[model samples]
Target chain A: MPQTADTNRRVVLSERPNGLPDAKTLQLEHSEVPTPGADQVLLRTRYLSLDPYMRGRMNDAKSYAEPVKLGEVMTGQVVAEVMQSNCEGYAPGDHVLAGSGWQDYALSDGTDLRNLGQTPQNPSWYLGILGMPAYTAYAGLLEIGAPQPGETVVVAAASGPVGATVGQIAKIKGCRVVGIAGGPEKCAHVVENLGFDACLDHKSETFAADLKAACPQGVDIYFENVGGKVLYAVLPLLNAFARMPVCGVVSWYNLSGLPDGPDFGPAIMGTILRMKVKVQGFIIYDSFPPSLFKDFIRDMTGWLESGEVTYKEQVIDGLEHAPAALNDLLLGNSFGKMVVKVG
Target chain B: MPQTADTNRRVVLSERPNGLPDAKTLQLEHSEVPTPGADQVLLRTRYLSLDPYMRGRMNDAKSYAEPVKLGEVMTGQVVAEVMQSNCEGYAPGDHVLAGSGWQDYALSDGTDLRNLGQTPQNPSWYLGILGMPAYTAYAGLLEIGAPQPGETVVVAAASGPVGATVGQIAKIKGCRVVGIAGGPEKCAHVVENLGFDACLDHKSETFAADLKAACPQGVDIYFENVGGKVLYAVLPLLNAFARMPVCGVVSWYNLSGLPDGPDFGPAIMGTILRMKVKVQGFIIYDSFPPSLFKDFIRDMTGWLESGEVTYKEQVIDGLEHAPAALNDLLLGNSFGKMVVKVG
Candidate 1:
């Protein structure tokens, strides 16, 4: 499919990060394009999803999921095309989304491939709204948060994949939705496009007060994806019996370990107890019932078909450029779901 | 009724404790017992239940229940006998349990008195196994823990009233119960008398290791009342899907404030996320349901009658000595429920 035959290109974990990782921590090198055997297909990656969970896999410590081993391909989920297939059901030219990692091409046993069908009007949507990030938001917020009509629901990371879905779903449930993002553009998109009742920018100098002013009716459900100063700001604004679904903690991920600064855990715990709130950290796979997945797919497909939920994607040009894209995502510089167009 | 027309001794809060209260913080005095009104019944304190929850009342901090104000009588659940009655249902010589204070005579409007009736094998048992403490244990452990048969359940302050009942109830539910207590005598009481599968001494140099050995299957439900080194030891031994019903914090009551030591709050948060463990704090009055209270009374009464469960009482001599008894109770120096024999 390419003008040149593909050689190897992979990113390896050079060393565990003591704090935030620098470019020196990741070593990119040329290697052989792995071959496909019988009942296997060679995938040419078209899009790679950069997510907060990738930070967890980069570390060797125990977490909800397994960490990627050193000297291995950095693990990720990607939308790729089958270059050649010697397996049943999957054939050459078929598009699929699989955990293809950060590489130009990967050999799959045809076991993990989910067929993306023949025609995709927006192929990158598979890496955004129709993907793991979307599912994480849908299941965690709807099932756990259980927002009621007239309730005020708030979500941080307002423009990102998970947070966007969370705010949109809360709006669907008839709750007054508030969004918190990093900049004016993202905040504008959240309120105008996502239909949030109000949006606040965390980067604002008066961010905490802005959040408090936006939600005059105290927050009933806070989809907690960020646990830093934003969380501290959100705590006092939380009403009695608030539900906090802990989907991610991107702010602390780069720290390598618990920060040595003033610990905010006590403050959070005290707030939870006093407010009679429930803060539950859930891995989407474990928390969502299979029935939820069926309902999500049906509703989400309809929303996409009807244009009720709009999505944004920031696409990187090539697999060679994925490292920079990942850095931008980790640094919260990328505006939306940052997708690396690998092939 | 005796040499004196009314008992005049009372213990009132003189000064709030900086950490844990001392005898000097409480002032015992001779106060006149006023006559009862048309709807009021004068009660003579028989047995006052010295519970760990009273520690919170000593501080002015907001909690599920209001804190005891300085110069007011120390609040407690008391087994008292009606000396003079002006209400319709209650009369002289009737015994009842009331939320009377640390005083010789208390006047209640008969609005909140729970008539214990005249006959009892041991009236003091109403303050422990047949009382609020047992109900607290039962309601929290069964309603929240939801321990299936064969699950390993652990409880701290094992020889204390609530912990003893918690371990016993879990055993009744067909669980392997491990009890953690302060010393050898109490630990022995937990295993031999309360029928715990195993018991660990918290004061031991090898406590953590001993706890691990005792819970080879890992702890599924930890009835967490005392939160200090005991919680630290239990954290690592907790299995996935562990449930922690936090009914009190007796061990921390002795301190005026946080130790000049490293806080374990962040570590606790990280652990909860990694294990999907649920740690819930509840007050008996706020979250304790009456249906569970009836169920507990029926089951615990049966257990007591059948000789399956036994409790020890640490009775002090007079109402005048209740302040010292309370100070001892808060310090965990009293072996059992510190009751004032105010006959």
Candidate 2:
């Protein structure tokens, strides 16, 4: 079942899922390789970055970005190499960061592609630490959370790219960083490797008490990514004048409708008012001024080189494994930054 | 009964209310009028401001400020005239804005009083248009809501002091302001008198539809004060990157506990993430820098003098009417700023 020279392989949206996505949601299809039109470039994807945000794009619901249409190639960011170029600035063999999606090859007009040049230290790194997730961690934390020295910063999904980066950055800024992860192993890694002051396993029955004990001063800034029980636990622990930069709520992505219970809306509102907390939701690109990205790159690169910031990648080989990998990511089974090695 | 010259009439917190304050919550008492000590001033109250936030201070719950103690004069801001002074800066007959609470007479150490000097025009104006409520509206709208010109800014409790001030300021900033009020009369006042672009009656069955029709561009900034059904309706209409400066939730102030229903917390979190909205809750003084107050006073005074802002007051005649006036304010029966003429 190897692809022919004239053919391109892609994963397309087969059907929309009701709650969690399954294997049947996406289908692999083969078509004649698209030719580069005038002012267009042919891109061969080397790595496809799989993120929790993709779960949102799968639904035909209104969001900051449009949902992927059924029978269309699944949208994603990819580290790709230019195969053929009809665009003036792009040339064959040049590496780039582009929204080539879940595909073997894509036709781009070079409008949105970022040239990574002929060779990058690690091309796939551009898809994770040097790309959107890192930028998200930087912008959301520094701009919204605005953690100060002696403040306690808490983040969920501690081993994941965004949370790991956020916790480390907080540590670098002379703050107490506590991470919330799902298992003991992840928790240990978060504290031991990521330099977090403490890491609490949210799976434990005493998770709330553990978090309270760990953050003696109460949480000043909560980098909210996972919402549900974690959010509920974080709510009471949030100190007066706390800042919650909500970049994602991956846990609630699969919910069909409102959960069955006494509404917590009033309590949430009450906490917000009584504590004078600032809970701001933002997408990285929406909030980040393009000028800040240059600073982000310089600082992040230095941190990476100094070993102050470490990143882990769960590389699932082949584009065909993307569906199962994405499902694993949503299930909290993926250990780190989940990226598909497409080429 | 007429108060004797030697006795001071005061309202005290008799007990904490479970849901809403009633007749038994506050007890009227009389005490000997205290003589001013060294560096102190004796004051006779002229006006007492009644606000919905006082309802929160009645509860034995943790909040930004401490609850009113049992059998202590109920906390409030007042416009008062100095009767005697041992303090260097004060003199008899001087008007001042002070936290004198619900009482006919008080002795201040001249610490927190803002001297208004002798017979200033409308001294009670400091308790409404020139004071805390106006400051709340100014700081929250300009600092948090940050409404830009051509953007649609929505606010609730449209004719009340804070809401009225917020709408007028938004209008001054060239934003298209839409107000949500309880009745047609209040809505009419909001649009015609307060200079809002449109005002919707929340009591109408087609309220949500009316809001939609009025906000054709969708809501860009929601100055959240009334946070029950009004908030629910506004949630769906919030545009991408919308800013919600949550200054109050007066509608839920009287609830004994959480409302019974399927939990909308997850839905709120989801909407926040998908729409990339910014929801920041703040208390006026807590969020505003002290330096901003001078600028606020200068600009607000200009606005008032130019007829760019107008205000209304529902003034009760006596100190004994304070509790009922507060209840009326919370119940949305009070037309505008609720105050007690205590002199």
Candidate 3:
């Protein structure tokens, strides 16, 4: 069943799901490996990054980025080996960061492909801590949240890549960080391993009360990636002039519609007005400047080397298991950064 | 009643209303005029400024500023003429801006009074165009909204002081300004007199469609004062990186609770995330520094003198009519700035 040069294994969008996506949403098929034309490079994907934003691409709704078309290759970011090259600066056996989709091999024009060079300590690190998730945490917390010393910083999905990075950075900046996670185990990991001041389990029956008890001075900066109950609890605990850098709303991503009423829109708007809160949303690439990435890379590398920052990844074995892994991510069943080792 | 130096007429908060304030909410009573102490100044009220924020002060709920206590004189801003002076910077016939409450006469210990020189073109202008409302528009729009040339700026309560000033300033910045008002007359005034590119009547059956039609390029900045329907309409029309300076939520101020079901909080947050919107709330005095006031005064004075900025006021005749005038303001019945001529 091994793929030859004449055939490639790939996953394509079969159908859009109504709520949580299932096996029927994606179809695995075999196709002829794409041939690289002039100025193009052929890539064999080694590791594929799975992120929450990909869920948004499944819907037909208008967003900052376009949705993945039906029956087309499912879009994703990958760390790949340049198998063959007809373009300058690319050579056989070189690794690269490419948008090679959910496939064993892809053809790139070398236009947007980034050369990761001949060797990396851990190439999979480029898919997590040294990649998009970490960059989102860095730019959003520093640029938008702007946490001052001794301020209270709270973030949801505490054990995940973005949230873990946010909490750790806030600690480095001398702030009290409270993290919200789904289970007691993740909460323990957030506090003991990630250095957050306190971690609350959102699944607890007295979650709201626990969160309030944890944030004695109220929340000054709320790094919002998960919405729903966590957001509702955070709203009341937000201090005056709180800054919220909203990067995702993973909790509601699978829901077909809003929950039942008394509509909380007015309450949210009213709280924002009364407290003078600043709530802003952003995409990592949109706000972070290309020039600033050099600084980010330098700082993050130092932090990792010094053990000031620690990272965890949930590695799924094969590309065919991506659909199930994505479901686990949406349901909060996956820990840390979720990635598929596809080599 | 006319020549009473012995008795002073003052209004007090009788009871907090369930929703909107009525005649029963405030009670006027006569009491003996108190004598001023050594460092105190005695003043007779000239023009009393009635603003929308006073509605928040009437509520028992928590807010940025303290609520007015039951049976205390209803808090307000006033332009008063000094009848007697025992303070260093005050003299007879001096006009000062004071938080003197709704009354015919009051005694000040000179703590929060600002001395306004004897004569000016219009003393009441300090309560509107030259004062808090104008300053709010200046700081919120310029500092937060940051509307650039060729961008579109939208504001609600079109003919009122805050909205009018915001639109005019946006025009001065070379932006396309669209305003939302309650009626045809106010809409006409916003377009013809204030020079807004277009003004939509929120009271119209097709208000949402009309708003979309008016804003062909989508809204870049939304100066939100009136919430409810106006906010709902503006949400979908906001462009990527849209900035919303939430100054007030007048439309929802009188509501006892949130409106019925399928909660829109998730929808609002989702839109914010997808579009990368920035929504911030602010109170004028909290954000603007005193040093910036000098610049604002100079710029506004020049604009007024050059006929680039015009204003309107709905003057109510007596101190007895202040409650009714405030009700008119809350209900959107008042066409412009609501002021009471008390002297």
Candidate 4:
């Protein structure tokens, strides 16, 4: 049986980034689409998530997974359609969760793709709130931080997918949620929409003071996604027994080398000792045991269904815009989940 | 009953020390001892245990307890016989654990004294294994470190009381123990008499490299009793998810201020995050919930009785020698518990 030529366009990393990745770091290429073999499925990328985690994938550093190799398509989560499949439970046109990266089309071995039946509830939600970022917030905040009612939970990058979810969950747990975002608009949205008790503008000169005032009772849990000055500010005001579950250090992602300042490692450990604080670093993959996936989906699906947890998405139309959108996302310019619409 | 006249012999701070205490920083003065009140007891110090923790008390910084007042009696763990007692449970001839300090005799209201029975299992053992130093090692190593069998436990200042006890307990739990001490003699004593798997002399020219070789399995539980260079050396070799129970910083305690040169606080926290290590600073006074004391004593007494553990004491005769002895103790010159017999 003869088959038509593969029709797929992918954005590949043309070069490793210098400081912040520019459009020059990526190249949009049209190539023959890969055919799904037996036990594999042909996926048409529907929504490609541009996340802060992709920054880690861009660099060849030690992380939960290997970094995306140079000249390869950038790696990310995607919502896609199964055009053809030899895998069980997935048929033609059936929507699924996939890691199709920066492409218009991809082929999955059916290893980690989950089916989404017809009549879906926010199909792109599977790329975000119903997926990895949301789960990162849930597991790290609840399981590790273990915040109590009235305890203050402070989350940096407060308006993004992970931080927004973390803040809302903390609020839902009856904790006073203080969110820190880069600007007043995002901070307001965090407080108004996400139900955060207070929100601080990290870009403001009085950011540290404002954070201190907002957390009158001192912070009990700091869900650390942006770990730079935000961490520096959080350091002094941490009450004894504070729990810090560190997922990402987005603030320092673009750095090619060490910053221009004295290293604060000893003082941080001293504060950790003086306060008996626990700072745990985990990727979502390591944060939760795999067995908790079903429970997470069940609980989170209910929360979304009940409207207790709401999500926001900043969609950039076209795969051609992904590189720029991701660059902006890395710089904290995006207000929520940055998804590139491919199909 | 009266104390042998307050010889007025006392070790008082003459000046604060920088790096290490010298004779210029401390002075011995003969002063008259005060009389006991109706609610107090007159204690004639029989055995004074010079502990590393006293180094921290010599500093003016806030800690688990108040710093020793300048010109006041130096704080220490003393095993004394009651010369006179108006209080119950403590009578003439009864041995007691008291903060009798570095003095010829002291008047007490029985504030920080716990009386030991006359039928003693080596009364000085109270200061080493059954008293504050022992409890510090036990609570920190057991509660904080939580070493499992076959895990490798590394302790610095290994021939000292706390480190020795930590090594023995790690061995009893069936873990391989690597002891780091000051000299070849102490290291030999640690391995042969204490039955550690291996002992490394930290003062050796190949100290860091030798430690790396000796700890081929890497350090699973690093009982951080000393800080400074030892900490710098251990940081890289820490296994993922290693536990560091920091009880004291004898290495930095004698310093008048923070250690000089490059600050590595962020690097340390980064190591902690990337390695998922748990470095907790603890004070035993906070750990003992009172219910565990009886169990601790029973087990320790049994261990001592069965000759499973050996304790060493370096007794300096007379109260007048305390100032010089304290200087030497802070400099890591003492081989074991440095006790001044203040009879």
Candidate 5:
């Protein structure tokens, strides 16, 4: 809640971006707090999740999800509290995970809201580890990448929510997890905190060679999140029958146009053919069944409690910094899961 | 088996060519037929299978299979007559499938030979529809492609062995099959003889538009064998959750260097992510279980007998034509399966 409780502060897409979003791309606006109608709950956002996928939604391109229209509330997931409720299942003071976008308050009919009850432990976590990003990591690595016990799994954006979770899960599956991060600090965190076998900094001059050195047996499962230089480095190092579960391409998300080149499109295709690689692009919501989320929450909760899996989040206080935070997330400056403390 | 029966003629990789293999790329040489040692069978080549995978073996670059060295006999599969046998299943009149090179006479230790019994029907068929190419189509299509009924399947090199078999099998499974071939004649054969629902001439100026028109439902499964212009066309038309079973890239096989461009590499990866596509590259021999071949042969044999399937081979007469036949096969000139009649 801001100083003025009666005013609902929200961020709306003002314009589409050509490359990195400028300050004017998203505009902060104030309006009267929305009233709950029949069968609707008035929710006040406590935390708003800023993710790389939001960048794609900003583009007016054909993708898994529809792009956010100009002047519309920017699409996002938020962990919020119900201030008033006429909805049957959700009551006042209930903490619910809602697709409320980047806002202070929202009215929901309870269809997209996941009730977490009052005073839920680490309620903000619903926007990170116990929610979409971690779930994406779990499903993509287990279902598509299918990491084997002795196989090597290389993940990009290693300290980010999805990559960290993927690396940790791969470690749990007894795989050799090699992580690639943008900076030395994140790389260290991936190895020391997340318990990955090795973490290579993509910022290194010999990053590609470093990746090859880290995985001498060749990468069997590449949990692809960042798709520019990391992808190029990982391609030649992929073993026969390598599986690449592509969840994000944050590195290329802001690319307005293709870079000049001896186009490597054919070379990539040729390598895929010659190496017998399996590259699958997937959106977690579209790829996995809803029932799997329960299993995931159960297993992840157990893993967290047992000290087997760890999570880290860069929580930015105040919702006003979200636009800049998202830019940092896309540029690989965020050390881990990037989230906003809205209230 | 030849005009000079005692002379064993073989084609050796005289030199590796930059673009396409020219007259100087392979050299024909004559030698006295070697005597078979104990447990070895003296085989006289009857038919040699000329498939596109051979193009990859000509390059020195590392691939699934080792490259054919400078002075080594050009690698290929052959249906041959067992002229002499010293051990176990001793027979002189038996026909067998052997990993014999481009030579009339070769000694196999029976380890790599599959005995086809004397007086088998259409012995040359063993080098084609019953062998690697057709089996590749069967496994790649059914296993990886996994076409559902009424779904659209777009296959390139649609008149060639793999593509033809894939389209036919997709039809058997109740798919709307679209075939893409180089010219009008081959496209006609793909639709009429191969029983595909539609065939688009890839040589047409409006090939991309023609493909879009032909596949009104968009491509659900793309049985990718040729991956140049055809791949460029298919990428945009792919439906969500589309599966691409990449079996070959004959178009890029002869390329000495990559084409200059504003690189489409990032665009390809972006499409893969946005469309949620599955692209799997595979070599038939490496992908399937050994037992599946028996199942394939049985099912394929039944389909042929019941008139549910058909096969065509452009059999080039003379062992001397094997080099040119392989060149033709890579160039997409030979219609259907290209085989050299060695006997």
Candidate 6:
């Protein structure tokens, strides 16, 4: 059913999960639509973004971001529309990028809203290619990874938003791009569609050897979004002075306990020392200043318009599907950037 | 023994050790003193530097540099006198820095020689405070760690050459420096002599808590020379945007096998991601260009002359003591930069 003017539907965190979030993690609730106060705007979430980072927010542990509290609205960003505006420079029916979260309606003081104007082509793109994920890939690949021409760049989670963008940008910078994904379908898409030089199935029995064979010259830049076995395989293959830009660890987010193995910490740190590798972790929030954001938006827009870069997104309909979709995302069951069409 | 013109005493690698090198690892060999050919100079070893990194060179495995082959002269640098010279611009009785290894005499073809000039004051300082260890500390701390004023800087192996230099430089940069040493005596010296704000004994039962108490503000720059338990302690105490410059991993160098424990690799990488930390491994060779080396020499000379930085050295008499000295250095039994007074 479409969002109604008098009622608001919200998904609230009910309990913290021990491992992967399940049915008891969230609950649906109905409430009266929040009204705008003085200099305030009422935002109705049109599209809610479901990202791997949100899985981290579900836990009570300290991370780069704050954890979502029980019974609170699940923290997220949305492509929202101004349903009512008592604020300056805002009018009804205007689209915006706001932290409206997993709710039908929210009250905003205009502090966190970026104006998208009266109409926009592909408004949800503000949440994916033209927004945080793309900016993450751009800044991380360029600033930290510092890809050089003819160098090898390895990106994990090949078909995901950040990985796809990183691989394509590496390719643009004249580097040989190698992508790692869970299945053959995603691997095929990564090479044929995303234009990676090679895409290896991370689940393959010979994944490590296959990766070594694919890159004659060892990896120079590793865009690390997936940790676990993928990182284990990539560690030995990294060349001297390799740069690893750590964006996320989606693979380990759901892990409740340590995996059984010999403590590989020494080996990892040893490789980093022996190879003189640089490993830097980053989050996109507050990292991109106005100048960088402008550059990203300009370049990313042109790339999309000129067909130099392509984006794939998996849109799940309805607000209730967000919880399950996030689970799917963590399991690598969903391909591309997954989002919820809330309204 | 003082001036052996007819015979040269050399220490060669007898075998690669599984763990720590013992008496059988290196063998003392006697040979005739080599005559310098055309464009070559004969160097009589005056002082030979023993370092922890030499332990890695003793292993047959690949590392940042080549391993020392069995029966080959063990690789090292020395402050030597040019007893004979056939090369232009080089003459007899001039002191110079050369990779002469653990030997009484070596022939150089005018390559890898840094002339110290005749009558140079404190020629041995060129191997410690004014040389590779100091340079490694300077570049790794400033170039990679990038300490800011009012930040917390932590140095492992604080009594060692590199760590001492790193802690002092961080202090000079207006950072609050915390030093980690093996014993209380070294800890006291680190604070009272080296000018670190505080020094903690890593062997203490409450070492981790003591470290936490010392640095009220979380660590911003961690000069990682000693890994193992020290790194495990520092991992949790790192603040956002912390920098860890991996110059050496002395603690793990002698481990012939993995330590029995749950693999801490995930936790290490996870902490790195959550804190947005930067960990970079660096080696001194070929890293310091002429410009950087010049700056390092000028600044270091000034620091020493002005008493802004103090250096400590433990000089073992005789070249035959080098292998035992290195073992002592690795076990943290020797304090300061250990060297041998070879003639």
* Native contact fraction, candidates in order: 0.12, 0.75, 0.77, 0.26, 0.83, 0.71
Model 1 whole-model lDDT (C-alpha atoms) = 0.79
- lDDT for residue B230 in candidate 1, whole number 0-100: 83
Report the C-alpha lDDT of model 2 over B1-343, residue by residue, as the tens digit: 4444678999999998988788899989998898988889999999999988999998888888999999889999999899999998999999999998999899999989999999898888898889889989999899988889999999999999999999999999999999999898999999989999999999999999999999999999999898888988888889998988888899999988888978878877887887888888888777878988888899999999999999888889999888988998998998988889988
- Please report, as a residue range, the 10-residue window in candidate 4 chain B with the lowest summed lDDT: B1-10
lDDT of residue A55 for candidate 6: 88
CA RMSD of all predictions? 3.3, 1.7, 1.5, 3.9, 1.5, 1.4
lDDT by residue for model 1 (B1-343), tens: 2214555677788888887677667887777887899889999878877787787788787555778888988888888889999988898888998998777788999988998777656888888878888888888898778889999998988888888889888888899999988889988888888899999988899999999999899889988777777887888877766887777667666655445435454456556666667766566666755777787888888888887777777887776677777777776677765677766
- TM-score for candidate 1, residues paired by index: 0.90
Ranking by DockQ: 5, 3, 6, 2, 4, 1
**B227-261 in candidate 3: lDDT tens per residue?**
88899899989999999999999998898988898
Model 2 pairs in collision: none
Q: Candidate 1, after superposition: displacement of residue B158 in Å?
A: 1.9
lDDT of 3 at B33: 84
DockQ-based class of model 6: medium
Residue B215 in candidate 5, Cα distance off native in Å: 1.5
Per-residue CA lDDT of model 3 for A109-204, tens digit only, reads 888888899887789889889998998898889999999999999999999999999999999999999999989899999999999999999999
The lDDT, on a scale of 0 to 1, for candidate 5 is 0.90
Stretches of candidate 4 off by over 4 Å are A1-6, A12-19, A22-28, A58-62, A255-261, A291-295, A302-308, B1-4, B7-32, B58-62, B69-73, B100-111, B201-209, B254-263
Q: Model 2: which docking level applies?
A: medium
Better of 2 and 4 by lDDT: 2
In candidate 3, the second chain superimposes onto the true chain B with a TM-score of 0.98
Docking class of 5: medium
TM-score per candidate: 0.90, 0.97, 0.98, 0.88, 0.98, 0.98
> How does model 3 fare in lDDT?
0.91
TM-score of 2: 0.97
- Which is the winner by TM-score between candidate 1 and candidate 4? 1
Per-model interface RMSD values are 3.3, 1.1, 1.0, 3.1, 1.0, 1.2
Candidate 2, A221-283: lDDT as tens digits: 999999988888888888988999999998888887888878888888888888888888888
Clashing pairs in 4: A6-A33, A264-B265, A264-B266, A265-B264, A265-B265, A265-B266, A266-B265, B6-B33, B8-B30, B8-B31
